[model samples]
Target: MQSLDLRRSGAGHAILVRGGRMARLVLSAALLAPLGACGIPYGTGSRVTLSEAPPSAQSTPSEGIMQALTCMRDSHTLNRIRFGIAVHSDGTGKSSYGYEGATGSFLPQGTAAIWASEAVIRAGGLSMNYYELNTERALRQFGGSSLDTALATQQQTRVPNFIISTAFTALDFIGGPSMDIRAGGIGPYYNVRGASLEVSAEMYRPGDRMTMAISSLNRQVFYRDAGIGGGRLFGKGKGELVTGTIGFTDQQRLQEATRDVIALAVADVLASMPVVPDDCRQMVENLKAAHKARVNEDRPQEKPAHGSRARRDDLPAQSPAPRIPAEQGPASGTIANPDKARRNQR
Candidate 1:
């Protein structure tokens, strides 16, 4: 198949572009403003930064790459849904957070604090361990044993590509209210600033040629903070999300992106395997050829004969239907999962 484009301009731009005033104000105030304003006068919104182990802590580039690869190998959707559950089947810990609110009134202090916040509210505040559990489950569903091993072994060289791809897939799901929960707040309260996320993954094969796509998701926001006494003021805040952009923008895009990468990665992996069936090998080649053909068609030179809803619908479907199996899955809401009992016990 065609080569993967690893040089992806992260969703930072998109997020910032979408950020509107809140984001621009943050950057301007944070970077350009005088020193006096930097410390206190300038309102700073929340920031979420993925804190990897210290550079000295890692042994090699491979280690660093593996860590980055978790953006996909792990499952974000499962974690958000499962952890969102506040009560156990037995009944306890019925508390929930991360929903819509206004003026930050009547919201709890700790978990409830996130409600009045925007994306990536606090850098290094969120724990990786808390997120790791759900991602582990997500990895298992994708037939991966462990993100660590998946990133290592030369046999699975394309781990980074897949990880990045999966990250975007999960983001789409999380950010898209249709899949995850999307909350809104009262104006003059919490305004989103800028946001960015980059995810990378790979699939191991004997040689070159793996399928991966980089996606950047970004948004810019604007708002005035309002409250009583300490809370009420002409408070303005700015925030930005600047994770890597090597995956889809949202979840719907993720499903399509993952399947495409899997198809390409599987073909390459099977092509290199010593113990493989001829039928599978042929299938791989066939898929690769098809993908290459489609990519060529997408070149800038080729313009659609007609660009309209009717014309677009007339085009052949590019992907197959998704196969979502039914099981006792976690609910995507607070106070919904049985695991909340476990939290209560803690």
Candidate 2:
């Protein structure tokens, strides 16, 4: 069982007084492909399919899993997801935006936003069921009912210009144990401990739609105090667990379980713009072509005689991708066919 140091500040005792309780939370991805639409929708009872080939092409199950996992690990691609709120003032002033997961405490600007997005996608896809449940659990545990209420209100409040972007990545997983004790009756409870607590996060986006859903469980055991007198105590042993989900509005849609979805969205949007750097587009195109060529080369083909061998000139020489700035958020146009964007990448 995990140990707590209550000697200082009686912190453990205070937590008990604050009314701690065992709870759980759960949360709910990306891509740009142009042969078809590129949005991934998640639900409480949904089954997701991954593909190594564009949606139209068939892939072995293992291939799809590998491709999905690799895409989620790319960090440079991860930075583009963003979340924030646009606030308008009465009469005279201009409108301003405040970011979610943004704070000067414990982390730098955008740190939480970035990490949270990655966490969601990596954990899985964010879904509505997970987001609402997780948020409710957190608020109840931390005495943040007011914030929870405010969030609920915001979901129903309609604003013309609101967008949220999210992605799934590796950092979204965490584990730990939490204990809630009832102490009003029978002397103060002491020496209670838990072991091996773990947590995972998922996120939902604009329109209160699910973005990514992630769930993680860990081993935990709770033990209470045993003794008499002022120091005397009776112990009851029970297990504890927590599950939760988070929702993001505006630019805050990214979650560890949805990074691939976000990236595909951004890539798709950028593909339509005339102003996007040609070099970047060329690079992505080149990558696609090279991948195609590699796939073709690996296919079964009849061996040719030395005298009839085809010249290298028959194959198109692939160009290398040019390095360019990363594109953020959803791109300019709706991706037409997702199959093209879903092309296999090694």
Candidate 3:
């Protein structure tokens, strides 16, 4: 009897365990079924769709350079002077700081070179010899005897009329004394910060070894903020205060400011160069249109208003009307004049 009782107890425990497991399996399936039906993916992979990326913050600087070039070309002051740019140097030899404690040299070498080259090309009065710098560096690397022998034996290389050099002389940041206070569920906060970058640029005639033009430009970029907000409800209230600053330590803004100054400096230097008559007005206009198109492309497309027809601009252009042969009469099944047909019927 005791053995039979023990066997029965063991069977009951097994049944309970099996019932729990079945319930758990059903619950798991119920939980996962909705996800499977919804087509939610599992695992580590992700799906991405191709898209047109928005323009970088550098667009403003590029546009500034373009506008400056256009203006110079329009003024008939820029001549197609052959020139080359040297690597820009940080004369200050000091590191600059941005938001989040980011640090970098006062002058970025790559940026300076690119900005100068672009400005020169866009202004339309300058011919750029891209290999000028490479050739110079190669010659320098060969050193004394080899350089002399190469120069003596090989044909002379074309020298640029002017070599452009730039330096970042100074960078200064000021401000950060900000205050915010909240009382009676209301408060206003204000902050202001400013930064200035000074750049010096010079154009040298390689043959004459003379400085043709020099420009020192100081550009100041600033940030400002002031705001007030408060909320109250049902004899209970919450207060908040916030302070914000802009332009200080903002890398993009700094770069834009630097480009603006560079454009101004380059324009000033190019003003002295000889100007040849070249029709670049159309080119400038085309450039402007391209810039506008890019801007429009990057803008978030607005949805059409409800119940409105599709915009005309979105429609395909209408084709011209097909030419009709004068000798061909109306089709056999078509009436030339509906009014005549109606009169006949009447």
Query: How do the candidates rank by TM-score, highest first?
Result: 3, 2, 1
- Listed per model in order, the count of residue pairs whose N, CA or C atoms clash below 3 Å is 54, 75, 2
Work out how many backbone clashes candidate 2 has. 75
Q: Mind sharing the TM-score for model 2?
A: 0.21
Error of 2 at 4 (Å): 74
- Candidate 3 C-alpha lDDT tens digits along 1-346: 9999999999999999999999999999999998775645454595443578987763535554566577765665555466777777677666757747455754565447667766777666565544346676667677777786776464346456788877788888867568676675567767778777788778888867888767676666667776765543433355344433322233336655677667656655664443522233333334434433543455665342111222222334543444466423333213687766566557
How many steric overlaps does candidate 1 have?
Answer: 54
Off by over 4 Å in 3: 1-41, 44-65, 74-80, 96-103, 126-155, 176-181, 228-252, 274-346
Cα lDDT tens digits, model 2, 32-125, are 2332343444666765566667457542213333343234334233333343321111121222245555432211222223433333243232
**Alpha-carbon TM-score of each model against the true structure:** 0.19, 0.21, 0.50
* Candidate 3 lDDT score relative to the true structure: 0.61
Pull out the clashing pairs in model 3: 79-275, 80-125
Predicted candidate 1 versus true structure: per-residue lDDT over 1-346, tens digit per residue = 1222222334565566678778778887787666654446333674444468856652221222223223222323212211110110111122334445433322122331122111111110121222224555666567665755663463343222111112221121122112222223212222222212122222222125443222222211122222211222233564443222122222122112332342233223323332323343344445445444554445554333112112212224633444344322322322476577466457
Evaluated at residue 243, the lDDT of candidate 3 is 38
- Model 1 CA lDDT for position 83: 11
Stronger candidate by lDDT (2 vs 3): 3
Q: Say which candidate scores most in lDDT.
A: 3
